[model samples]
Target: MDYTATLNSMGQGLCYALVSILFIFLAKKLDDWRTKNFDDDRHIDDGNLAVGLRRAGLYLGIAIGMIGALSGESAGFRTDMLYLLVDGVLITGCLFFSRFINDFVMMGNMNNDRECVKVFILGDGRTVTGNTALGTVEAGMYIATGFILNGSMSGSGGSFVQSLGSALLFFVLGQFVLLGFGLVYEMITPFNLRDEIKQNNPAAGIALAGILIALGIILKASLSGPFTGWVNDIVGFFVYTLFGMILLIGFNALVDRFLLPTTNIATEIKEDKNVAAMVLVQATIIAVALIIAHAI
Candidate 1:
């Protein structure tokens, strides 16, 4: 064992850690412009530590993903550092653009806005306003997006220009598939997602979060296949994404009937604000995702 090589590698790891932390700080700033209803200052002022911590988790996830993508190919220190910065910036930009599309184009502010605290009208006609699960959902989405895109971009060894093109293509196609899934979810559900979330329904938020993560898992699996042409790869991703959606829907239907026979998840979430039920719903979604991820 060469001590010199070992020490050098340790130093490099420390440097990467420092730079990754910096990138996380910068990524959070970049995401700030697109994030809605997640006012950091307000949350902090109101002593809502959960919201603040979730935001950190989201940004850190993005940074870590970018760092992982930028690493693994041996190169000079300066060149690697430059690539890391560029990868972080580009990935962050892609995420921000996706959020813009989801918020402005897809949601259209019709879902009653994505605020942390929402007013819920109970069955007894009582209006209760308080913090909701959107914060957790938002954080989950960012982390899931990072996981998907990072996994897609990894190991596609190429020049900066080639890598950038692939990243852009994957990002656009992935967002498109995700939007389609959202529409399908809306169609199958009994109530409007936006309205439910606006009513401070954490159950809705959890379900959506689970779907996003599941899709990300699906996308990662689809993209990790053999390197084919751009057209073939994109088309293949769409097909796999659809299959994943079907699997998710089917699993949910079965669970709704069999897993907890007495509990109607949707009603419990919408009318009862059953946080435990919501957590179970999320767990089911993620469990399916993990199973698919492993199978793929």
Candidate 2:
């Protein structure tokens, strides 16, 4: 390799190491926080440790698989497959280390005198807090993966360091984008479908389905051509599809609860009008945000 290429590879490796260290530290801190505040069960339980490790492994495998696919050269399908296998194993190994540390901290801090707290694993408006430590770990992995993928594309020669840095940047950017989309969706289309289900509102369900379909269409459109090509160039199309699905579900729930009400015709009509306006506003915001981000 040329001098510049050598330097680029070295830099990428360093970046990967730094990214790994950062995530490991984050996982450890999260574990500490969880043990101090959340896990009241005094005795260290293997079950929680196992669960956390499994979750980490699963996410790591996914990230690696994704990266491998994205890194494939067109010359040989076999080469692509090998790349996926190797990278997936490497990434998964790193994830395992992070999980091990997380588990140690959590289990070590368990106190026998305290009762274990039940935490919410999913959903909004939940009373109990979920495993924030695990969440942080997962998020860290995603960020790391995004950084690595982007770095590789930027002529960094797929060095671990460069990829990790690029993945981290993408993770931050993705979070902001998701947050903006979420808030805009909420403000424009607030409806409670849970309440509707309790009251058996057929129209509410229909409205929810419609909203989901519309959002799906918009996502498909946004991912067309150059935008999709660029995203695929880095993280691959699968990740984008997965992300789009997540957003779809979240948006659907918001519409069901906030936009559609199980009430009189007059109220429903009023709500529908609001929902239409909200949909327009959300669509516009999402389009604008995507355009701006892509341009940048």
Candidate 3:
């Protein structure tokens, strides 16, 4: 065995161990803060805020480390490190900003008595299951992977328009995959899948699948041309849908189980005619943000 190789491996192991310890310490601190200000009604928002702060801090630290490493490394290391730093900063910033916006919107909705939560298309009030979150994450992972591949496959001096179109096509394909998996899971589950779809019944799932697949094909077509265009209209739809569903169900459950049926403003808004309109507006904003993100 090469002594130099062994020493290098030990150094890398120490670096990872230190990073892990720092993460653990940060998690412990955040947990303590949450316990100190624990209010059942506002737990989700508080937790989100804590997570956002921690993520921002972690990313910033990582970015700084990358920059430092790049400053003292070979050209190849410098190039790779710079990419890592930029990507880290972008991801962390997006996450923190999104969480902040979501929290603000949630609070505003509560104050205005609007219903922002719907678990499924059927408007069933169920908390978001782990399966749903995993599905969404998996879709996101695939979309990102596709984007990286698109960039790599684009030959030297590739058009930005072509690259962007390719990324969007991949993203829509990822969404279709997610919906397909969800449909399959629904069919295999013990519960009636028909009850899960909105007004259209089980056929609704089939309809949605068809629509997404068609959109994916359209995106693929758009990428074929030079001008570059997006085929998918419903960007970040799944994430927001899951979030709204989980949040609404969890909040309603808390109120029903713990608080008395007080004639409060928030409760009144839940039943108001304007609640659905508010949800539509929120959904539109989310869609726009997602589109802009992809474009950038």
Candidate 4:
């Protein structure tokens, strides 16, 4: 073993750790500042899962988006830092915008910012507040964007500009794919998913969130690997995304038929608001996504 190389590796890891900590700290502060409606610290202390989950998503997103930049061959310290900076800004900005897109589009008319945390007035006129079920869906969007960025930014074959453009394009594509999937899911479900979420149904939210994040994972794989050419890369992205979607749909069917054949999956999630059923579905979907991500 070369002691010199080992020391170099250790130093690089330490540097990465420090940079990651700083990014997370700033992401937290930025998210809190934008929330505007409630004291994040206070709401978290009061057991607001909605606020907490939203916060966690950003945290997780920052971490996930950093994976590609942190890994791979270092192009000298200065170049690595430059790459990290550019990709970091893109990841952060896209995630911030992702919230609005998800809220306005897939959510179908629900306002996540307004619903995630709300203020209520009691008979005594004292105000109280808590996170709503919508927070989970927002959290999913954050994490999913992170994954898409990770894919777009991964690999070392492209020019920096090319890679950056790929990242942006894939980010947009990921959102559209997610929106498409949402429509398809809506078509299959017997109930109105957006309505259930509006009624504060956690199960409905969980199921939707699961599929979003799982698809994000798959897209990460789809976008990843060596960048061949613009045309090749774009074609490859769509092809992989289509394959991933098919696999995801197939697994959902499997879960419904074999994994939990006794119950109506829709009834459990939409009617009974069965968190456990949704959790199981989510777990199965994520498990399958992990396998596909690894294979890709």
TM-score against truth, every candidate: 0.84, 0.30, 0.26, 0.93
Q: Give the candidates in order of lDDT, highest first.
A: 4, 1, 2, 3
TM-score, model 1 to reference: 0.84
Candidate numbers sorted by TM-score from highest down: 4, 1, 2, 3
Let me know the TM-score candidate 3 reaches against the reference structure: 0.26
Residue by residue across 1-296, what tens digits does model 2's lDDT show?
49997896677545544444444455445445645754423322534432343345334434432443344233344553444444444444444443343233322332211212333432345443233223322333333333333323233244444444444444344334433433343345446443332232333323332333233233323322232233454464335535554655565455445544543322452344243443443454344434432542
Q: What C-alpha RMSD separates each model from the true structure?
A: 3.4, 14.1, 16.1, 3.0
In candidate 2, what residue range of length 10 has the lowest lDDT sum? 106-115
Residue-wise lDDT of candidate 1 within 1-296, one digit each (tens)?
A: 99999999888777777776777777667555544546665755776533563565467557746755665566877777777777777777766665556555445453313354445566689764443555555555666677667766675555667666776788777777777787787788887876775555667777776777777877777776544667777788878887888998888788777766887767876677777776787688787888897798
In order, candidate lDDTs are 0.68, 0.39, 0.33, 0.83
Q: Choose the strongest candidate by TM-score.
A: 4
Report the C-alpha displacement of residue 215, candidate 1, in angstroms: 0.9
Clashes of 3: 1
Q: Residue 205 CA error for candidate 1 (Å)?
A: 0.7
Model 4 Cα lDDT, one tens digit per residue, 1-296: 99999998798778877776678888888878887666888878988778888888888988899886676677887688777877777888888888878889988878776776776554478754543557888888889889988888887787889888888888898889888987897778788888877767778889888988999999898887888988888899889888988898888988888877788679888768889888988899999999999987
Which consecutive 10 residues in model 1 have the weakest lDDT in total? 108-117
Worst window of 10 by summed lDDT in candidate 4: 122-131
Error (Å) of candidate 4 at residue 226 is: 0.9
Model 2 misses residue 231 by how many Å? 13
